[model samples]
Target chain A: MEIKAIGCEPLSLKRVGIQDGHTLKVYQDTGGYVQLKKAFGMSPDEIIQHVKDSALRGRGGAGFPTGMKWSFVPKDSPKPKYIVCNADESEPGSFKDRYLLEYDPHALIEGMIIAGWALKASTGYIYFRGEYNYLIHIMDRALAEARDAGLLGKNIFGSGFDMDIHTHTGAGAYICGEETALLSSLEGFRGHPRMKPPFPAVEGLYACPTVVNNVETLTSIPQILEMGGIAWRDLGTEKSGGTKLWSISGHVKKPGVYELPMGYADMEKFIMEDCGGMLRDNKLKAVIPGGSSVYIMNAGQILGKNVTLDYEGIVEAGSMLGTGGMMVMDETVDVVETTKNLSEFYKHESCGWCTPCREGTDWLVKIFNRISVGEGRPEDAQLLLDICDNIEGKSFCPLGDAAAWPVQSAIKQFPDDFKKWLTKKANGNGIEANI
Target chain B: MAAATPTSYTDKVIVSDEVAEFSPEIIAEMNEHLAKYPPERKRSALIPILMLIIQRERGWVDNAGVNFLAKFLDLEVTDIWETATFYSMFNLRPVGRHHIQICKTLSCKIMGEPEITEHICSKLGIHPGETTEDGKFTVSLVECLGSCGTAPMMQIGYDFHEDLTIETVDQILDSLR
Candidate 1:
């Protein structure tokens, strides 16, 4: 569902416009794997340098520079290096990676191969979430086609480099989206996130030097090479290079994915115009600019401040541009209840690795459940924030931070709603937590 | 799932000695997945083989299947349970033929998921996480399946049913039977 494609040029999604776009024949005819050849011609150091020059930040959420991440992998290590693609798009509001995987699987394959070549890794794995099992066959077909065309399996483009990519599926743990936890899951363990000093870049899969790139980050590689690094960097804001895809959802008239250059437009204009405005003629009450995990922004904070959907732009507006999965809420949505709903998500997906996250999310959900049912105390908002404070950076991974941010922001922004729900009872028969 | 009964689970470390037998073709498939990782790291293929067992069992991961996998991968039974309970997709208990996993996360919730969940439950005459008497349907309120752009979605079997309304839910259930 490409609702409105407004961008200077397409990077990852360009192949989506062509008929049989996902097929190897059409992808090659339209210059799909050409970047791999270009990347092959360049030295490994040169490719990494090019990516570093492009200022290509991680599209997953953390906005870390991709090339810097690659450079972290120790060169000439005794152990073989590995490239892992974090295709597990499990963030609550994020769905753009699924669209890319379903539409242009080859871009991801090319990116993985190129990353492998740059890092001198011969093996790569694309960790697909178990929910997207339907796409496994499609990806397999794409891989088979690549192999038949000599784009995969041993010497590629006569570069004498051998690389093979495999697809792995996770059952349903959201924490597996975290790189270290992903490596843990890939190694056949519970998806518990490990401590960061031994980051995945240093001692990843099988304890070897590994680089885990997100789906969007890896997919952007082909185009980053296609257009020289600096030229690509100039396409967007001075910092966040190239185009970004925004997954616009919730109470919007045109709720779909839109590819727009980074910092292309402000929140009010993007929501009111590009998204065809709010649904049911309701006034836009709030906007979660980057997935459900980011701070919930009120209309005043976003529209009033003229916020943009870039990494730095969102940070300036007091939130991270996490995954670019924007969830727009209109006047009818109850912020307290919505915040409670998100708490339930955090509670369900917590991997029970650390005490703060495992118990903090559960406590938040319990408190929100009481708040929704009109049992909230006068100090409930403060108490919720207190729990959030414990969970902000105290857990093993960012899931704790993600679980805490929205509740903390909602209380700070909509102080009245938390108290308003304190006096209100939920309407209609609600299902018990049977699952 | 066994996760609910942690006390009894911790008390018992018993894995059934009798393991389920798989056909030669299924074993060959397991071998193919095994070959994906290094020989010493056969545990890396644990997830794929578990998926294969879940498909063969036709509902959930049973002790028999777990025992078989532990033996097949040379892993302890504890290894299988750790993974099984950690992830939401693997069913520790038996499920009906068509399992409906409705997303109850924020994106779907704001988009009328409570109404949709209620409608599905009322029509099926069962609460979430429960299978009907006829053994035809089991409904689970799962977390986000990454379809938030088209919110208020669910997964029945392997297919996603998104942007759901009352009529669509009714038609989907009727067609399932």
Candidate 2:
């Protein structure tokens, strides 16, 4: 397998593996709050302009430009503007955000101060997912430490800047990771994605101008401010800037989170070299380059085809760089079964906001379930694609498109796997496949 | 995705007018959560308050608890139930002392989750979503818990057990008992 020459350099995860790393003292000792001190010198617009030049994009699935998103928040709004950190990392095959929150809780706080300065927001909320209840205490303690140190409350660093960060726990909705849905959940309402004409910048989080950013994306701000924006931009490609934390899982010998430079890690080398090769030395069958929401790639397309891990490279390979979640599958695994499990996830997590996503996700799960139990029809494949076509753009939110992409790409890349299920024998829940 | 109103997608929840009572300590704890939000936004403390109710009154959100929260937080009963039922972590019914939520997402499924789930169920003498007759354990098949890197995992309460094998499952359950 051919490999890229770029070496590993820990940026966001710099303090993740350190001892007592979540404490404020340990973090401050390692130059944690320096960026917040530095930001006291520059104007909010200057910080936003520096980030725009840095070219840092959202690490969440959308990949929206971070600086541009902050700029979208109205500067002249009378209402209390807010900054929300989307710590609801619920994408299947992704676990990068939890690592940052678990080990280096103060890094996010320092980054939030800088992000808040750029957005001119007073109060910030970290909308943590419910399953991560353990990290809440860690965050609460860190915030208390910062508060006692006079770094978080009024007149922080004696610069007359007042900001407070709070942690809001999500119940358990994957859709809550979406900005609007997250806003609704934060307001103690049902987790549903609202229509996006006004957008969050115009009216969000109690109808105030809000800037929702991903955990890793916001965590990169402190570093971006430390190193000049031009230097940070140089670390990544022209379009996708800065190093990203990639959550690599499934059928790999060593499946852990790796922080690699954008467009630097080749697909073959990522699995073979960085991951210590595939599990049990099995041959690669397929790879979901991003999270399960993105398209799936067959072995031929990923093995030696110069496929990259950045946004442009993965998009060039007909997929997205969603949350940098790479799920690798070996030849022993059944593609149809994997797709069925993923379909069930979307079906269960569907907010039922739009008819297309609510009904279409259930249909996908049912069809895949039938195929798994040897009760599928030959015509079901075409019907599945037809349903995907309806749900992709018809739904109100991206959840529908998230449900459609995996099923459509699974069949598109591995049609024979779905077709062979028609006559295949099933042992209770799954069919034996040699696809 | 559309602007569907709450009435269009109302979830059926068991409602009761019987208000459950809390201890002084627990009420004080709920007050602490209430202190996090602004006085005008008392509804913002609904979730954490309900969580405390779950911890104090049985192991799940019951009709009595929802009614009490409605009075405590000064919100409509439907509002409390809507937020309670939307999240999977909030148990709408009674739960066993220990709730085992096995992640059934793609990554875990690919990494022998079926076997791990089966072993846990068979040993516990119940199926997924069913609590043990002794009320000691409840085995549930849940969605991803964001521990995909260490697949075939289950979360019991706040603790996560990853890289599950049949042997490990047996040991973990035995230690719990």
- Put down candidate 2 lDDT per residue, A126-244, tens digits, no spaces: 98888888888889999999899988989888888889998888888999999999999888888999998799998998889998999998889999999978789888888988898
Off by over 4 Å in 1: A423-435, B1-15
Candidate 1 positional error at B93, Å: 0.4
DockQ (0 to 1) for model 2: 0.52
Off by over 4 Å in 2: A1-6, A423-435, B1-15, B52-56
Q: Model 1 reproduces what portion of true contacts?
A: 0.89
Q: Give per-residue CA lDDT, model 2, range B62-164, as digits (tens).
A: 7767778899989998899788878888886667899999999988998989999888999998999899989899999999999889888999987999988
Worst 10 residues of 2 chain A by lDDT: A1-10
lDDT string, candidate 1, A1-435, tens digits: 454468576666677656778898888888888899889889999899879988889988888999999999988798988999998988887898887888899999999999999999999999999999988778989998988889888799888999888888888888898899999999999998888888888899999999998999999898889888888888887788888888888888888878888887688888898888889989989888898889998888877677876888888988888899999999988898888888998888898879999999999999988877676666677789899999999998899999999998998788767656654435423322210
In the predicted model 2, the residue pairs found to clash are A354-B1, A396-B1
Candidate with maximal TM-score: 1
lDDT measured at residue B152 in model 2 versus the true structure, 0 to 100: 88
C-alpha RMSD by candidate, in order: 4.4, 5.2
Model 2 residue A249 distance off true place after TM-score fit, in angstroms: 0.6
